[model samples]
Target: MCHDWGESGDGAVVVLEGEVGWLSCSLFSHPSVYNYTSALSTGLNLFWYRLPAGHDLEQPIGYSQRLSKERERLWLQPATAEDTGQYICMLSNKSSCTKISMRLEVLARDQVVRGCEPAVAVAPSQVIAPLQEGMTLDCPDLQDVVKMADSSPSVTWYHRCQKFPTWGSDREQRGLSLQIHVMLTTYDGSYYCTVHYQRRGRELQYSRSINVTAVYPSSLPKHPSILQPTQDHIFKVEQGCTQVRLECRGHFPYLAGDWDIWWTVDGKKVEELNNSRFFQNNRQVKYDYGDRTVESVLLIQNLQAKDLNREYNCSVRNQRGFDTHRAHLEQEVPLPSVELGCGLGVTLLLMLVLFVVYHVFWLELLLLYRSWFGTDERHTDDKEFDVYISYARNSEEEQFVLTTLRRVLENELGYSVCIFDRDSLPGGTITDETLTFVARSRRLLVVVSPGYASQGSQALLELKAGIDGMARGGHLRVILVQYRPVRRQGWVRELRRARVALALVRWQGDKSRELTSRFWKRLRVELPVRRVSGVEGGGGGGEEGGSEGEVALRRLHSQNSTSSQTGLITNTVKEPQKVISIAAYL
Candidate 1:
């Protein structure tokens, strides 16, 4: 009845009376990447017991054991016949405990159970197991009798070797057919199916060991191989050409699996087959260097003076690993061969003669607007204008207005006028002298348009500068050409402070009218009467007393005829034309 318990090459086994217990070399303890630990709900509990010598019924003594709850391990000293019958190791957190028991039946060699498959291999089909699901694997046939818990096909699942849970139908419950509702990591390896059945009134048990190698992707490539030199290399042929080859390898579990490889040159991927430069045992870089011949071979061929001292890299890869190697060649080239001649010089001269850009800068070639341009150097006696044209982005439109005004002033009235535009500046510098022009001018004509207002931050900044100039008592003129009529509410609030309003020209309506020309004629008539000059009105080019809002509304009214007017009445309400004026609703 007394028996010894131990581990051997084939796994746990039982020895009957008068039998020599054989231990396989595999059980001697070797390095194993497959080693894992199991967890129980509570501390580990080890139960050791044996039958008395000469009596199968007497309780055996002298069995002592110790277990570590923190380490989850149990150790027994001097295992003997009276020391082992059934040794049960159980883990429990006090709340719950899972138990696994091994029986040691000592007997003669002739009493051995024949044809029991002690070896089993379980391969998981997936990386993660969802709760309440069963995974399938090829079950090893053992002892001509395979029983999951000595019954039909349902076996309770275990973490290490402790029962987790068991449930299944008769059809869905055999061999590897037990299901446990447990959300588990891929590393949760302890699992097995046990067939439980009765035989001859004695309790019989058959269990298959479940070794779950939780399938998951590796954290890193097995072999991180990289090419040394870049594929695109600037090389001096006098030294040597760069020669590159693909070097590939991987590590860990990937070595036990299949993989592929590939390569990229410069920025483009080089297919393995098309290039004659690559030579191998029919193994192209396209195969990912998996084969023996292509694993570490250089793809660049014919290292010559032309390719000398160049850089190139060879890349190798697979599903779980990658590697690269860069190379350099040392073939020297004669520098004396490179030269230039008189024929080439003559061709260059002819091209220079034909191409204008070769002789002139782009600015000198721009369209000349002679009358609308000015110099940074202004004469001390330069006559000041009643208005300064201040525009941010609409240089073209400003130039057109400048041309018209210049003709109106000089040709028609024989007055000297100066205008500044981007084209007017010889070197495109908006210098202090430009600001001086703005300061000297009696009035500033700011052409407001949506496009000009939104050109950039600089355009807005320029508008701000113009406003600052106006605040210093210099006249500020605003010419709001109805450019698509997009309402700018914020700008209107700011413009309310200045004694100025837009010249409202009637848009294309059913009513026939010439509002722009009439406004110009009105401006001509008002110019002599309202001109502000001298110190009290000095630099304040606009008339000292007029409501800007009234002017704006009056201009708006002038554009409409009584017949086409909306059903709204207009009345004149006397109020200060302050910059921040809120007009009365009329």
Candidate 2:
């Protein structure tokens, strides 16, 4: 998300007091070392920092005669205990950054105490040797003695604190390292090494311990296993795919310790094919238990007729075993020519019909996808209402809202819909609570109509609150729903600004009554992508809910038949718009 500090490498540098010690930047130390001045000439910058022990912050290193920083090496002349800490070398350029850290441990000269107890514990070293194999073990930390004495030191090796007999013991003593003819389980023990060197006209002894471990030639199972291509497999190439890859995986174990899996096509190595179309790649996987697996893929680009019959083989091998698998590529059989000729006319007609249906009912298809696949908005936000209807009261728009729009949104689509007349309760101040409802809702649905914003209504106040909530809180979305056509000049400034960015939907009375009609589909598209679920009075979790198409058809029939529905829309005078008492819905 921010700056990547890049890969870091760490080690330790041990030296003695009153001696000149050099710590080469580990960033440039490959097997030996890299030229730092050459890297600087190539457009890279380097910086050095000192991190004292027990301190969280790093202090930048300054060059001086006592602590000279010459290019990539940090030189400490007459080393002191205070100089013991971590040294970091940072290398960076325009594109990337990296650093290397090394612990600098400065030790003081010790008095000659024979057969003394260990005053300091050295960092334990782990060396792994394969069983029954010849290996070498070096005495560690001799470099510290070399640094202190300014001369190469003599080393003595012991196992379990006893002189290691060399004759007939399968072991030999080198200058500062030891060699074993064969490794056994008994060899897996701590070995001690003592460095004897002359420093300042006096002989000093430095002793440290090293641990060795005996490992199996191959961990767990010894035999290699081939994991792909069951006996006599064939791959049928598809019609449109231009490239194909034949992957072969193998498990290998070896004391020789090399992944022996490879791919050969038609008795020739994939690399030896000499054609640009044939290539192979390999991947190796290692486990914590000291075993590994290798996989190879043979890729064929722009396959030709001659490539179909070629045999592909994957082979795996270890010192213990070897296995190979073979397979072939093939082409699918073609359809009969008679059937293709007879089906051409019918296929064209079917495609034309399908295109027409998709063009006309794409909205219905989108609505279905939303209910089935879209996420619920409540999962991401803390809100009380999903839809808040702010329609003018005592008007034809109110009848449309209560009868059709509110019923469809709440009962059919299972949204948390809030209506001013139905949701306002008797415990809070009406003016403040109504605005609170606006604040709590995620979507503010404004019903614009010829009768909207009547002389005594608070429609304009609610509209202003919705706009302010969207601007300040930034989570609320305001949607304008046109109940009937009105002049552009008649709309409030807030509604005019909103219409500039929104596509307004016009109501067409009975024509837009069907839930699948263009008007309702467009409105549903603008609503939030949400999961539809069972709500109160929704006839939920049963046959009625499962068959939404049938339910919408039933409602349509009820509207048409006056015998089944009451004529309240044309006859009843709207109830005196009730003021809130405070709580049922906001």
Top of the candidates by lDDT:
2
lDDT of 2 by residue, 1-586 (tens): 1232333444577766554466878878663544577778878788788888788877899876567666777767557778888888877788766676778877775632225333223555887777778888876756644765746788777775466564347787876778889887777777777677765565556556677867675335678888887655787787666898888878765454554888888888877889889888888765432456677888889988778878788888877888888888877776777888779968998999889888988887888888788776777898877888888765477677777887777556656566655565443455576788888888888899876754335676677778888888678888888888889888867788888876678888888998767887888887776444443345532122336674565455435433322333322223222232222212
TM-score of each: 0.26, 0.33
Query: In candidate 1, how many Å is residue 454 off?
Result: 34
Q: Point out where model 2 deviates above 4 Å.
A: 1-355, 454-457, 530-538, 541-586
Q: Write the per-residue lDDT of candidate 1 for residues 274-335, one digit (tens) a residue.
A: 76665432243332212222343435675444434444555555555655555455445555
Give every collision pair in model 2.
425-581, 425-582, 426-581, 426-582, 427-581, 427-582, 428-582
What is the Cα-based lDDT of residue 390 in candidate 2?
87
Query: For this target, which candidate reaches the highest TM-score against the unseen true structure?
Result: 2
Error of 2 at 106 (Å): 99
Lowest-scoring 10 consecutive residues by lDDT in candidate 2? 577-586
Estimate the overall C-alpha local distance difference test score of candidate 2.
Answer: 0.70
